[model samples]
Target: MRANKGLAGLIAGDTAISKVDVSTSSLWYRGYDINELCEKTSFLEVAFLLLCEKLPNLKEFQEFEAFERAHRDIPDSLYELFKTMPSYSHPMDLLNQSVSILGSFDEKNTLGSNSKEENLRKAMRLLAKMPTVVANSYRLSQGLTPVKPNKSLSYSENFLSMITGTETKDPLSVKTFDTSMILYAEHGYNASTFSARVTAATLSDLYSAVSTAIGSLKGPLHGGANEQVMYMLKEIESVERAKDYTLKKINRKEKIMGFGHRLYRTGDSRTAVMKKLGKALATKLNIHIWHDISDIMEATMIEEKNIYPNLDFPAASAYYLLGIPIELYTPIFAASRITGWAAHIIEQHNDNRLIRPSCDYIGPNARTVEPISKR
Candidate 1:
């Protein structure tokens, strides 16, 4: 018997965290529409909505932000550890290692009961620290000193500052970055979230679950697609060559980096928000070439293959124009996605069950193996 390949279209389980409606090509965090959140809510607000199951009022948000700010700094030992990782290590691996080491350092993260409150505390810790880890890891690998986190900046602005070594307070840039975080903050039971839930189902600690999720997100088919999108555009280089280059890839049956998604057949709902942000940034910065190349490629693909661009397509260029390095793209994805991962982990542990599944055996009817000498 043939098993379902990659479990496509299979209903693995239920979640109240987010809704991915392929029928309408829409995504919702809890019940809030993603587009609405991107437009009207800050990233922290979206994250709060995901974790708390309701939108926070101004007073609640201020308290939450202050609490998160208190935990933003990783231990100095972690900074020393970051200095020791080989310069060749992938930034994602560094992040995973950092989380693991952090678990060892924080008793609350490792030894606390799997209560909702405890999980929320740990989630806030991870959310506050991940940006610092990612930024400092990238900087340390570049032989540069790590920058300290600023308490006065908002979450999105602080992350931009840490990575760029300059305070990020521009309204448009902060808005675009915040919107990207909100767009990426969560999706219903995507690969990384599923990995997180599965690990949580085993009663593992939060850090292990998050580390596993990070490993899952590092795959090219998932979070890394945005990084690959930028690489593709850099190769094409100009609008004049965009269509021919894309067509050539199609002719050779090469997989395009950011065209189709598993869930959305027509278009990713998040794409429009990111595309708009990218266009605004491009125009604002007077850097139209990336946007021009993207437009031609998008038109070419839609006309030739009927494939629409996903969020990654525009996000790659948007982050590029924001002065972000390509290597940090997925880590930035992780920085936002930790909120979703934490929410799912809490949900799974609240309604705990083992997630074991079966597979069909097809090798020689399961005959006994021969001894090594006889073979």
Candidate 2:
């Protein structure tokens, strides 16, 4: 029997959290269309919706925001731990390690139960602290001082502030970043989220599941694509070089880092929203060259191969224009995706069978072991 490669088109399980409708080229979180959510709701509201299974009203939203702000500070020892690591370490690895370390700190709560209440608390804690970890780990790795989260600012503003080591109050920048978070907050069983569910199905603690997800996301084909996309942009570096660079890569049949996604044939639905915001950001920053180059490459890929850009394509330029470091891109993805991953983990724990699947016996069938030196 042939096995499904990478579990393509496999319906592994059911979810009420989100849906990816390829028929419509659309996504919905808790039944709300993503584009509408991005336009009207904050990232915190989306997080609440994903975790609680419904959008929060005003009083509930206020309470949820307060809880998140209250838990933003990780243990100081985590910073000390960050200081001891080599600067050359990848931010994702550091983030993965830091999350496991956080599990140790929360042993009392995490070890006791897989109850939804307990997991929800843990999820909210992870959601709150992940931005701190993503920002400070990168900063500390660069020999800079860690910045504390400013509760006065909104979630997106605070995250940007911590990463850049300055207050991020610009309206456009904050909105763009918040929109990216909402877009990335969830997708139905992408690699990382699936791995997280698999781990959770084993009754693993929330942190371990999240760490497993992070490890999966670190690969180039997944979350790391954003980082690679930025690097590719930098390599092209000029509008004049963009089309030639893209066509050369295409002629060689190289996999363009952010051009295609398996789930969407026409294009990633999230990409258009991000591209518009990214172009606006580029215009606002007086940095048209990146998006200009992107336009040439995007048109070339679609015209030549009928391929379209994914969310990572525009996100790379957006983050670059925002003055974010190339390396932090995937870690930032982790920060946003914690919401989705935790929701999956919670869902899995609530209704789980050990996620062990049978495999096709492709190796030497019915092989016999010979005694040592008997041949």
Candidate 3:
């Protein structure tokens, strides 16, 4: 009876924030090709570029590093609140609560207040805080005490060392994690990013906007795809079972998780990169289960659905290799994506437009009847 909106084909608003070059099939932060940056740059380099609109010089990087280090500590009240949380509580839920606690101690509510610089600073703080909050939450969920981020290590390295107490000589984990962050930093109008934008559109605070993203990203259809992929692999178990299982599912019109992508008909661009990483990690792990499972899933999807693996497929295995819990997969996604979300919010604010949308109502006629007795 009416259009569903789906927000499809609707130019609800304009953005110069960052461009998704779907035609060229590339993403650019500000004006630089992200692929080029990823090849030659560190995650911090890319983050600086996204926030400041330029690749940082030595002094700028050093200063930014110092600033990030200085604010690494969450307020005592926030930590106390976290300490009191139940061990069985989801990390995302803990993070949602922590965000509220941190906001309560806000020296500068720069998110909706007057200082643009302070808002930017706050954005950087939240971005830096995400991994800490996640890793710390995990520690709390277990009996272990939460570790603070190392000031000596870079952001990428710090996250790793925090999760694993021992010093790691393996640089690959940090590199891969950072690369994953850059790859997943932002996508144009995805569910979670759109959630952030819509929240910002209402002129709400940044924490509120990003908390909305946490909820949006937790869904199986969105950021949960990676975990779902792993679950699919576990269900199928061996390579031998993959073919029969996938074929039966397809015959029954069942959906295969992490196989078909809504956007990419050819292949997922991030999957192209992650596949390379997955192969390397597979070699390192030298195990048969995941290696064979990933291989077979790719093959099965191609034969039955004609769909290629999206970003989620390899990411599931990649995180597994890094010793990250499957349950925290999407939370890690939020950690990477909060930077992009913050940037998008800032961009939305500068333009200053409310993102109200129109819907074609179609359930009933305009006239209304009274209660049952009166009717």
Candidate 4:
């Protein structure tokens, strides 16, 4: 039989855009490495690089920031839907639904065909409004009144404050969130983004495409990994007990929640930065339970089985410190990933392929015509 594919370890094609260097722990947008960008650039700067394929000069970035601010507000209907939703609904579901609702609003816009500058503007609205929707959705679920974003805050700070009514005012948290958004901005044909690309290939509305991606992101093996990581830590009571816990799971062949990744064979590049961010947050918050547990888990995993902490390990703690609801972890990922989704959608639209890949038949080989309703 020919090799079956989940496109596992296959080089589909060259993307001049960016590459995720899993083993080396590097991310680049166009040609600028993410570490450098995280130190020197804003998330919007990276977004411009991914979406428009170039760094925005000072004037262009200012114009883009102005445009994003103008579109950050969500419709009242979205707010009502969130308010009325039961606390039981995973926050990501609210985001998915809210994004779909946004599509209806976008449909009413003059840019129906994604053809004019207005269509691009509508896309910007989505990029801006998504964080608002996601943050508000969780706050609503928590029964905490959502705070309107203060334009004075940068995107990350505004998002944090909206989620938790307290103004963190910590520039480090803001910087970390921004960098995670940049790290997550795009990766070629990742699961959720591929889900986005596939939906967009049908010429679906951006919100529909993005919303579908949000749903996929909710899976534990996908964006839900971080939430699961926190849950797992919350399960194990202490660092001393972590070894036995992890060893038992590994021996049973149960997948460790945050220890691995398909794309990053050796390790996830983004994990190191998020881990640093998580440690800092833990120190400031004076709660090292999760971080301490993670340190033990990583040390044990590497010594026992050579497993490494992937992005989700630290992201779980970082988002928790940022006051994100556990269930909304992946939705937040969807919010950040909207950039990648939009980029891939635009790329697919320009190249325009139907993306029909072949599936091999493995069941009964052309079995003798089955008698109708065979017993």
Candidate that scores best on lDDT: 2
lDDT of 1 by residue, 1-375 (tens): 343788787888888999999999999899989998887889999889999999999999998899878788988987888788888888999999998988778776654367898888889889999999999998888788889999988998899999888898988888888898998889888899999999999988888899999999999899999999999999999888998999999999888998998889999999998999889998899999998999999998899999999988999999999998899999999999999999999999999998988886566655678999998
Decoy 1 TM-score against native: 0.96
Comparing 2 and 3 on TM-score, the stronger one: 2
| lDDT score, candidate 2 | 0.92
Query: TM-score of predicted model 2?
Result: 0.97
What lDDT tens digits, residue by residue, belong to model 2 across residues 173-240? 99899999999899999999999999998898899999999999999899999999999999998899
Determine which window of 10 residues in candidate 1 has minimal summed lDDT.
105-114
- Deviation (Å) of 192 in candidate 4: 1.1
Better of 2 and 3 by lDDT: 2
Error of 3 at 135 (Å): 0.6
C-alpha lDDT of candidate 1 relative to the true structure: 0.90
Give each model a TM-score: 0.96, 0.97, 0.91, 0.91
Tens digit of per-residue lDDT, candidate 3, span 120-209: 776788877777887887786776887887778888788777776655547677777778878777766788888988888888877788
Ranking by lDDT: 2, 1, 4, 3
User: Each prediction's Cα RMSD?
Assistant: 1.6, 1.5, 2.5, 2.6
Show the lowest summed lDDT stretch of 10 residues, model 4: 110-119
lDDT of each: 0.90, 0.92, 0.75, 0.77
Let me know the TM-score candidate 4 reaches against the reference structure.
0.91
